[model samples]
Target: MRFALNHIATPKLSLADFLGLARRLGMPAIEIRNDLPDVVGTMPAGAVRAAAVASGVDILSINALYPFNVWSGDVPARALALVDYAQACGARALVMCPLNDGTPVPHGDLVAALRELVPILRQYGITGLVEPLGFPVSSLRTKREAIEAIREAGASDVCKLVHDTFHHHL
Candidate 1:
């Protein structure tokens, strides 16, 4: 069996070091992050792509666009930017996370947000992995809700579920 690493697994490592670690550990793929070490924020997409190529690590996804349930403020812009980065950096997908702050984002709103994101994600050839945060306060608390929203938005072809076991069992 093969395995991949998430950048959060080594929050203290530099992006270069993280890539190297993945290689040493026999992990051919990895999930980069926007938080903690924040590779997306600190490095250029080209540099990230180059480093991953150099290390022979496939970029599975970018850890997330937070509060993706709401398409307001700069969320749309941020989603575009993240998708652009994922494409430029050779990542196959963008991990789209929902609001986790106890605010209620209705199913209609969730579907609307997914619809808005799908076209952009398609343009970039990046799949959107909707990761429902299962915490009690999370706006989206189950994979069923995420899948329902994705289907309602007609995004089933481009959007997928993360199905985090930790969150699923939470």
Candidate 2:
């Protein structure tokens, strides 16, 4: 299997520096986080793309879009923007987390949310990596729940579960 490191590993490093380290360490891929100090989210897409090309490192995925499913009026537009950003950055997938907004989102609502978002993901040729946060307030707390939502949304081809080990044990 190919090895990949999350941007969290070197939060303060520039994208170019991080890519250099990944190449030196022989990692085939790296996950970029929009929240990182000096990286994709803040940098211009051309710059990020240039850095990735120069380093010869494959971008596996973008770290995340918060409460991706239950998007409000402008949230879906923001998500689309992120999807475009991911595509421009040569990233294959967009990681999406369930609602962690401290309100209990019903299972039906969760399914509805996924249904609404999956089409947007497919339109951009982006994979939706649904991550379940096992927090008490999180609507989705297990891979099974995410899977069920994907199934319910009829988006199995575009939506997949992302099991975060740390959250899985919580």
Candidate 3:
């Protein structure tokens, strides 16, 4: 089995340094974040691609796009931008996380959002990984829900769930 380090595990490191750490650890891949160090916000996609290539580590993914089930206001824009970035940076996928603020999102809404995102992901040749947050207040709390939603949205080909063990056991 292969293991990849996530940027959140070492939030203090610079992108270059973080990639270096992955290489030093013999990890062939690393997950960068848009939140912890805000790699997506602070650096251009080309730079991210360059750093990953220079270090010989694959960029597994960008940590996430939050509240992806909402599908309104700035969410669509954020999804588009992140998808674009993932494509440009040679990342394989974008993690789509649900809202975690004690609000419930209807199953239809969740499927609708996933449907809306399919074209964008396909356009950029990027995969959408639905990571169900298992927090008490999270709208999506189980992989089952994400899977159903993905199936309902007809996004099975382009979308998949992220089985985060910590969240699963939460």
Candidate 4:
């Protein structure tokens, strides 16, 4: 099986050091995180792009655009910004995680969000990797619901699922 490091595993490492670690470990790809301190946090997109090129490690995705299924207000703006960042950094996809905060977002609303994002992702030449949270409080607690939303949105070509083993066991 192939392996890619998620930056969350080493939140303390500088991007350079993290890339070095990936190279040292023979990993061709890595998932950078915005949630981690000083990782993708406030780094200029071009610098991140240059760092990826210098390190010779492919960025799998900007792991992630959070609460992506909630499509209105600031969410769309943030998603577009993340997509631009993903494209700029030569990442193949944007890891789109659903709202996990107990409160349920309607099924139709989720599908609508996917349909809305599908075109933006395609326009930026990036894929959207939907990662369902299986925690009891998660709004979309299973991959089945995410799959149904994708299907209903007719976005299979532009989107895919990230099967998080830890979440699967939840």
Name the top TM-score candidate: 3
lDDT of 1 at 142: 84
lDDT of each: 0.93, 0.83, 0.93, 0.88
Please provide, for model 2 over 60-146, each residue's C-alpha lDDT reduced to its tens digit, 9 standing for 90 to 100. 888788877676877687788888988888888888987786887788887887888888888889998999888887878877877
TM-score of each candidate structure, all chains considered together: 0.96, 0.92, 0.97, 0.95
Model 1 lDDT on a 0 to 1 scale: 0.93
Worst 10 residues of 4 by lDDT: 33-42
What TM-score would candidate 2 get against the native? Answer: 0.92
Error of 3 at 150 (Å): 0.7
Pairs in clash, predicted candidate 1: none
lDDT of 1 by residue, 1-170 (tens): 55789999899999899999999999999999999879999999999999999999999999899989999999999999999999999999999999998889999999999999989988999999999878999999988888889999999989999977767686
The positional error of residue 1 in candidate 4, measured at the CA in angstroms, is 2.9
For candidate 3, lDDT tens digit of each residue in 1-170?
Answer: 78989999999999999999999999999998899889999999999999999999999898899989999999999999999999999899999999999999999999999999999999999999999988989999988989999999999999988988877676
lDDT of 4: 0.88
In what order do the candidates fall by TM-score, top score first?
A: 3, 1, 4, 2
Output the better candidate (1/2) by TM-score. 1
lDDT of 4 by residue, 37-151 (tens): 5455679888988998999999888888889989988999889999988888888999998898888889998999999998899999999999888888888887888899999
Q: Model 4, residue 110: displacement in angstroms?
A: 0.7
